[model samples]
Target: MLTLACSWLGMQWVHEAGHVLGALATGGEVERVVLHPLSISRTDLRTNPRPLVVTWAGPAFGVLAPLILWGMARGFSLDSAYLFRFFAGFCCLANGAYIGLGSFDAVGDCGELLRNGAAMGELWLFGALSSASGLILWNGQGRHFGLGNNGQPVPFRHCAGLAAITVGLISAGNLFFGTG
Candidate 1:
């Protein structure tokens, strides 16, 4: 489950990074960012000029950043490109599901989206497109995780090392971002 852990943490970080970028783009001041491993991630803005853009940025960039990274990995012919691809797919699925599914429950960012003029149909469309893209990207990815011999295998040690490093970086970064 090391890989899953890393992917989860990385996804949260990237999603929040998107919000940070949006805030920066809109001249919003980030008052605090909560990204603890054990807590739900959120970005609190002190001065948000454009709430809709900031809210949308969280998931939009969350999915795009990893896709870009995966593209770069594939372009460079990295043997670990599958891992990056998997991460990208996972982000799309998670973020899409979070927003799409959240529409039904009317909570979290989706709630905020709706409150700020986002149509449920728009949320559904985003969810469907992103999750479908994730699934399409994940096709034929089984072999990378020691599944059928259809692709290059990723070593367990590398995954473990990645997990460790990810935890370290996120934990350290939180010191600067937590509750401020």
Candidate 2:
């Protein structure tokens, strides 16, 4: 349970860090990243077309972070494999849940994509990408860590509960922090 929560928080940080990296890559100034209740970035930039890229970058990096971590962890000792696996799996699940659960109503990368006229298929594509990546990472990592086959599948109710927790945390953060 501790590992699960830590993995979730790590993925959130990586997701938000993706935004910061995108801002820097696109010539925007990043003020800070808040990681208390949720991960949000404060940036200084002008309104322009780059916001779309910046938004997309979050999930992009979110998906990429675990992959990179997993790849890098390959050269290390096996004892630390669980750490990489947990983080990678969390990243995939976090991004996947954010999209697959329709939690990105009007504020996330998907919302930005929709506002910019992205087709529903494109949004579904994003969800598919994250879901597949997450499943692959989770299953693969489980195998690598000898967690055995025939693991118990997470039921829809559990997924819904997890989604609710995520949404609640973000909502609380936004309410208290003003979504800056």
* Cα lDDT, model 2, residue 15: 79
Error of 2 at 54 (Å): 0.3
Candidate 2 structure, TM-score to reference:
0.68
Residue-level lDDT of model 1, residues 82-177, one tens digit each, is 889988999999999999999999788899899899999999999999999999989988988877857556787777778776878577657877
lDDT of 2 by residue, 102-127 (tens): 53465456676577766667667777
Task: In candidate 2, list every pair of residues with a backbone clash.
Answer: none
Write out the backbone clash pairs for model 1.
none
Per-candidate Cα RMSD to the true structure, in Å, reads 1.8, 7.9
